[model samples]
Target: MHPLSLRSARLRLVAVAAAVLATLAAGLTGAAGAQAAQGCEVDYHVQHQWPGGFTANVTVHNLGDPIDGWDVEWDWPEAQRVAHGWNAAFTATGDRVNAEHLSYNKAIATGGSVSFGFNGTWAGVNRDPFAFRLNGRTCDGTVGEPTTTPTTPPPTGGESAMDQVAAMQPGWNVGNTLDALGGETAWGNPLITEELLAHVKSQGFNSIRLPVTWEEYMGPGPGYAVDPARMDRVEQVVDWALEQDLQVLLNVHHDSWMWLNELGTDHDAVLAKYEALWTQIADRFKDHPAELAFESVNEPQFTGAEGAAGDALTEELNLVFHEIVRGSGGGNDDRLLVLPTLVTNADQPRLDALKATIDGLDDPMVAATIHFYGFWPFSVNIAGFTSYDAEVEADLVGTFQRVHDTFVDAGVPVIMGEWAVLNYDHNRPGVHQSGELLKFFEAVGFHARDKGVTTMLWDAGQFLNRATLHWRDQHMYEYFASGVTTRSGTASFDSVYLPSTGAITAKSLTLHRNGLEFQGLWHGGTRLAEGADYTVSGDTLTFTAAALTRLAGNRAYGVNATVEARFSAGVPWRVKVVTADAPVLSSATGPSASFAIPTQFKGDTLATMEAKYADGTNAGTATWTSYQEFWSNFRPDYAAGTLVLTPEFLAAVTDGQPVTLTFHFYSGATASYTITESGGTVTGTA
Candidate 1:
């Protein structure tokens, strides 16, 4: 997901419906200005009593002076409608419904009133405002009850602030070098495959950040060749992403830095390249809407001491950023875009540094980027081997907050681009490595949510890393699911990669000898087990996903692939691990869990995770159960500060279901215990 500009906190975590009802039970409903004379008002009590529609009862009271008749109308957000209405006559146009001419010169005496109800199809949920107008004037309102809770993409929707408590979803980077359209023609990697993409999506990430190389994806250079086929293919993956309702962000990554660092290309060439790239991209995706955000650069690393030079670089890049936005000619004036400035070579969106580089731009959709990997060897080295530390975590949060606040004050939104610490060996040592990185990203993501800065997960490799990131601290998927919530969305995709690994029924899998992209659902979990006689060996594995027969969503993932070991086991020892083409999946399970190098992670990059082992018996729910409830907790209350599980606590402890909460006081202890849940909590005997 890209950064978004915010207004204030950008988001307010809404309570669940049950909680709302509970609050109401506690007498918590009050109009912000409810009793102010009950002024000239008309109240509408709306209800959705059936499956697909709503019925609203509008009660108009002549609270002020006697009125001959009144007009009532509504404007719905999702182009909703009115099928049946009563009392007064009704007319509908598009999403507007108007009611006029009361029941036969219906004139309400001082406090007298008239009521009318209407029925209409909702088709969707989450209706807000529910406000109306009386006699062509806005009617003061109240939220009687809403059918659905609005889902807000938080900290900041865009160009605003965030709440800092929400965690980030597991995210992936669709690096240009890999599956990006025209990447192959641009003299970079082309090993990206459908198997790879599915592998990525399967890792529990609902967001994918595509870092487009402006120079490579578009424009003309002495030796440059852009292919329309590849570009279309790129769009196709993005379309697949949209199919998943994944938060997708596209950016001008690598190129900005490549140009400045290489010092070979002049501003004219760079601008021309940028303009051409945006023209093609924006035009292609002009109608794609909010999910796709365009970022100006990767990290514009400049030194403050070198004043003029840095300023020129900053100014040039800013101009190009706007130039691209303008030339794209998509009227993308509303699409979200991100921009970053040089801070530390390692971290980009630093507040103070960006303050210096904030170039004036008329386009209102751009944001800022910040990338902090602690400090290369320092953060990932033996000396600093910490995925997160209290002080360090607090510092990162403070920094992000400062940047968020500063940018929001200046009207620019910010994003954390390359924030994960290195997933390297010299630093992180075992199954806990990715867990540590997850802790860090989760903490940072918490801040991102609060600060309203959308973040890019960074580089293709790291993205794959977080996927197979060991299972212990597996909050990435939670983050992923939370970032994107699509209950009734569709899944339409195009790809060419390995056939299904879960089933071998002729129809379940397909093979394209020379394929690069593909698509399908992550319908289940489970490793495939091929025929006997196949051995897990050194270097590579060649297993045929040939014998698999079903793809139920909850099965363990086992493919019949030749599970090759990426590490040298001095002697064969038993441990459970996942063996697949994915490098980040190499890990150990059981008594001692160990994640291998470059294979596990190199720098600070969160990726998918897989546990590996000499023997596979130790892999199962043992690990999954550990994280089933990592957060969320409940308890009983007492008169004293410590919870003593008084009757109030037990009676009022809504566990969402019937559960007898048992309370106990340990003799001479400072606190009491109250346990009540599906598994029930443990309490000390008094």
Candidate 2:
């Protein structure tokens, strides 16, 4: 429905996965030998280690020239036993372990590397393997590194990974351009510019995700090198984003060859190219700031018929991707890496596969992501007026809630990576449905916020016109923005029925006072102008014949708010604000008379003060706590007015002077008042 050819892609993926399974089942390992002219090297990284067990990732770089197949042999001084491995077949003889390339990963391009990992056990020492032989002869160059530690930490100021993800909520995705079928401009969307990225930042989005397809520009193996000009283009875009101070996610996308399920294709050659592509990518961006995140794949689906087999293979690929990025060194070691489930679906079974894959792995910088689109009815089946109702609301909330309970609540941060309601149904371009569609958009935004998941709206020349640089649907943007910021609540709607063709008059419309504010009025997605379309006499509205026509058919012209509420006739509504229930300062001592003001009331203005001194003038100064200290240090003294304990005042009450102090607060009206402690505790008054 969203035009990605879902059925065709899924079918192809399944077919490929099935074929790969068959090949592996046949235990096909290519010719193995060590060669002097092969010019091979290895990057051996110890991912994690314990007293008795260790996990290691080995990448064999074929630096010499293109070869059909190769073998890697390593000797362990410790009595280490290879428990299991992926991407290569492993066999042991005493202290030597030989890993032969699998049927799908045999070929090694000139500069490409074939990587695999194994879970091994050691009695006392888990030493790094120093001697590595490729084919039969010793590797020509020195092994790059034996540990996975980075030279520097991520640029998150010590914030937890989930905290970083949470801060990126309300992000925007630059979809359909970079991730287009052909190239950045192939999807008919204009080439993205720095101005466009800046505009997105100005609209309150703090992050941008750029999905690029690179296979089209990459050369055939030995190295499978990406075209330098193409890479330069990608870097330029990333630079624009970094200039805007926005977090960026660069990912592989839309490469039909690497889609995982292409049956009958050379699986090994395909994987070799995939690995080579990432090798060049990781090395190029290894020096970038931690703000740049790398997502392994857009949506990895297994190639086989069985879902379980697909899940397992998908997990292995994900792990390999993680290892490559981390092993590339530099800032990449601590950079954020996002992993996607099969087909990018958040169904329970897919999530189980993800959990199983990540069960034992220990990487705090990694996060899991999934896409959200109501698969059948809402995502594709478009209808007007009735589509955005309770059922749709439940669906949005339920999907997010399930993901939260499974991944978020369990400590892993989850991202609602790509989500959007279609702007227009292809066949019905003239139809008006923004009113109900806005409702659905708001539901998704608020639901994601409540579930502690970050949502990146997929804006692909949909609501926002790329050429015109204007919002095509103003109401939709408004609703989506409100949902991201507003506290959880429902909108207050007032309905007015009109005849088919006649003037209409209605009495006053009132709304609930529960943090709900009147936003606007709409009928069948068409907004009714305030003065031209209808005249409001106080709370009463008188509509013209044209307005009646536009609002007829029981379509319901209604007033709306960020949150839902009940309409009334003449009742006044007050927006809910945070206020202290009790006194912030009960008592204080020393040279100055000090009192406390709650953090929530920091924005409240100080109206007036009444002071009656025991003797001399009562004068003092007031200061506000710093913004950073307010949240960080928990020193909640913002409006705590301090009175100077002058010698005269102290003399008047020699033993313990008691000076009366009263504080008044005001906005346009006298909002509230509080009494400060004179010489003893005085409760606040509001």
The lowest-lDDT stretch of 10 consecutive residues in candidate 1 is 566-575
TM-score of 1: 0.42
Over 1-686, each residue of candidate 1 has an lDDT whose tens digit, in order, gives 11111121111123464355434523543543442222235655554322233445667655544566656666777765654444555566666677765335357666767666655555445253345554543443322322222122112244321221112234557654533445443433345454445445444444567766645454356423456865776677677665443556776665655554433235566555555566667677777746666666665544332444654565566666666665665536566666666532313333555555554554555566667664332243332232344556666766776776677556665666655555432112331233344445445545665666556555544334423433223234433322222111111111111222343322111212111111112212222343331222331132333322222122223222221111110001111122122112221111111111112211112211111122322111223321111001122111111222233222333332332212111111121112332223322221
lDDT tens string, model 2, 1-686?
Answer: 00111110000123454345334423433332332234556677766543334457787777665768766776778777775444555667777788876555778877888877765666555666756766653553522111111122113256577977875667788888877877788887899997787667645566788888887788977788999999998999988887665678888877633654542245676677768888888999999977788888787754553467667666766787888999999988888888888777888888888876666568888788888865334443322122455677677777888889888888888877888754353223322233345556656766786788988888777767778767776535544544554422232222332322234444233332224333334443345577766554544444454544443434222221111121221111112111112222334433323334332333332323334435534422211210111111112233343322333323333233444544433222222333334454333333
Q: After superposition, how far is residue 589 of candidate 2 from its true place, in Å?
A: 94
Computed on alpha carbons, the lDDT of every model, listed in order, comes to 0.42, 0.57
Name model 1 segments beyond 4 Å from true.
1-171, 175-206, 214-225, 257-265, 301-308, 343-359, 375-378, 384-387, 409-411, 424-438, 459-686
Name the top TM-score candidate.
2
TM-score of 2: 0.52
